[model samples]
Target: MRTVRLPGLERPVGAIGFGCASLGSRISAAQGLDALADAHAAGVNWFDVAPAYGAGDAEAILGRFARGKRDGIYICTKVGLAPPQRNALLKQVYSMARPIVGTLTGLRRAFRRMPSTRNVSLPLTPQLITDSLHSSLQRLGTDHVDVFALHKPAHGDIGRDDIQRALQGLRQAGKVRLIGVAGDLEAAQIALANRDTYTMVQLADDPSAQPLQQLPPAGGPCYAVVTHSILGVGGTRERVLHALRMAGPAAMSEMIRLGYSPKPEQAVAELLLDRALAANANGVVLMSMFGARHRSENLRRVQGTPKPEALQWVSRLLAPVSESRE
Candidate 1:
């Protein structure tokens, strides 16, 4: 429910942004639209989508949700990586599997690994940049998007003069209000270096790495850092909990009381989210919002995120023996 300032946009963005990567794919339109509406109603104004997202249908569903309310929300969609191309059999299987996997989420990973579900998108080009925005605008049912980003670009793509020009032209034309890079740490670092073209950078918010800490302090640079992949690392929660146990009862109790999660796993996750937001206090954190429970949980987490003491507690708990002693 908290808000952060994002340069190049007239409105301040919500701290928690809804990610539409599963909109039309894992979630049906009926539930997806309702979920999006719920998020918007809960003060989550930022929605991240891509042409490749939601089996290439997320933008349309989001568009349906944003109708008439366009001015109130911020949309960030990306180029590069189009949707997966599937045959009729796969499509039928996907349709049938959606409900099953939704209930049995553990199976989602297995489904994702099934062959030929997604298509490998073409490499970035100036024309693809121009063409993609037009298509995305159409799908999103908006005249312009708040942020248009390159999806997982190669190391060299960020500084390419032609690619830079393409993004700039879109901004100048009002097709996109801001240009950004959405990828890993390396890509984000490159975007930071090429601030002339990139005003935003989206990357994973890993606790071990704390990548978003690279952003300049408040009022120093106008760059908006959007972080995702928080708590996505395998076994991170267990690892943190183990370390906390090693630190003794005080550390565990402090984290649980501060996080306010009924379950230890949820509490640890909330603590991690707090650390990520603290690492980039002025930026947005993206989370997939399809299920009502998880959506509500994430919305609640943002209000308490960037909790400095919680971050400090987790850092000390997870610190190495030598460093923590120091």
Candidate 2:
């Protein structure tokens, strides 16, 4: 429930944001709404969703949850992508597959990163930005969203005046409170480089990559940052474990003494998550906490103290290997 005074924000944004990428896809409406309510009850005021999320049903469910509470919460939804239209049979197939995928990690990982066949990114144009925002507004049941973002945009798109001007117009027209770029590290850097045109940047925070090192620390940059993929995504979990195993018993013992779990995977997960929270102390770190367990655990982590030693461990592990002595 801890909050930060992010520049350009009317309200203090929660340190941990609720990620709704699986709202209506892996989770049912009833469950998604309940999760949203639980998060909101726990003082989570930031929600991150997209047009392509939850097979395009997340925004509507979130809109429903936001009824009478829109002013109390901050919403960031993205453009440039839409869900693929699924017929009744395919929808049923997805529903039946959810439980199986939940139990099988391999099946989940296979489809986790695979782009949907029909869900596609649209060409970024002024018309597309305006039209997309209009549709999103209708779905969100809000006239103006807290943040409007370009979904995984290309570098060229970021440089286009037509697109930036379109976003600026949205702000001028009172449709979007702020504009941002949400993509890989490159996309975030691109947006950060053009801070004049972008107000926020959303990207993954990998422990091994330590991409956040490239940016000025929290409260230093004018633009707000929203980081995601703190756990397991993009093989970060494995990389953390790899680093620990290679670092040998002394590092592991230190981690254990520092209150990390002895089990390597869990220890690595905790260290990485703690480091992310510490790194983005003044920013928002997105957590896909659809389940009750994840919600409680992550909220606890958000409220917990930052572990600077954890940050140092990850940075050392991920830092480039020095070349052999001449």
Candidate 3:
């Protein structure tokens, strides 16, 4: 596995980290544990989880899998967005409905450039941050996380001294090794600006939505810029197919120098991972994988050479189409 050294970390971590959001929600506990073991065996040392993921089951499953192997791994979990306290029956119901809600949320964002029109008001106080991290550590069966992040926080939340102090307390107490802020572009900028407070930032990095473009040329003390959502899976395949039809195979081969795969989704995934690696040169790129095969494929693609000029050409070609609707 490829690795990058983040500031304050004792050692470098795998460039391609495992995100455990699908555990116990999309995949069975056994499958999740098996895949995790496979990843660890294959040299993937970074694991990202949150209380909000699988309604906290992902963390528990990861905890169970990580029990004996904690010494060799780097675990990252988020705070500020705790799952609702629901009964066992309700939790099961939510587990079933989570995918549907996610699909609808994606659709809404695709059309509106925003997630869920409904209001989700979470208090981002210092106490909340402190409390959330405590709960997250308990769920993950770890006394301290390598990195503790504020999940999808607002810009205002990142500027608060109380929140910063709370995170500092965690670090001082050895409950967290590094402080991180995870969210969209705005939140990232806020975190970057407050370098004294946060040492890491995690954000989505999709083809259509490149948050890297918004980052300052000289970032502050942030050592790790972790990125996720590399696979823009849903409508991306159709878009890529349409582009292939219009550009033809010859143009694509000449431009990208990479031959097209029979599976367009696999091709797209490769391109996305390449672009992500190129964009975040000094940071880790997190991808969610259910099985070993998928994880291996992703690791291979990320290790491959990327044609940034070719990707730039494609982006320029599609720029007009993107602007037309606006």
Q: The CA-based lDDT of model 1 is what?
A: 0.82
Candidate 1 runs further than 4 Å off? 87-90, 215-221, 245-250, 321-326
Candidate 1: worst 10 consecutive residues by lDDT? 212-221
Candidate 3 local Cα displacement, residue 64, angstroms: 0.8
Q: How accurate is candidate 3 locally (lDDT)?
A: 0.74
Which residue runs does candidate 3 get wrong by more than 4 Å?
84-87, 94-121, 218-222, 233-237, 252-260, 304-310, 313-317, 321-326
Summarize candidate 2's per-residue lDDT along 1-326 as a digit string, tens digits: 67886777887888999999888877888889999999999999999999988878889999999999999999999999878655344356567887886567788777665655246778899999999999999999999998999998877899788888889999999998889999888888778777767879898887767688787544445888889888746676886688778878998999889887798887877777788889887789999888887788778877766667767777776655562111
Compose the digit string of candidate 3's lDDT tens values, residues 35-79.
888888877899998877754578888889889888889999987
Best by TM-score: 1
lDDT of candidates 1 onward, in order: 0.82, 0.83, 0.74
Q: Is candidate 1 or candidate 3 better by TM-score?
A: 1
- TM-score, cand. 3 vs. native: 0.84
lDDT (C-alpha) at residue 172 in model 2: 90
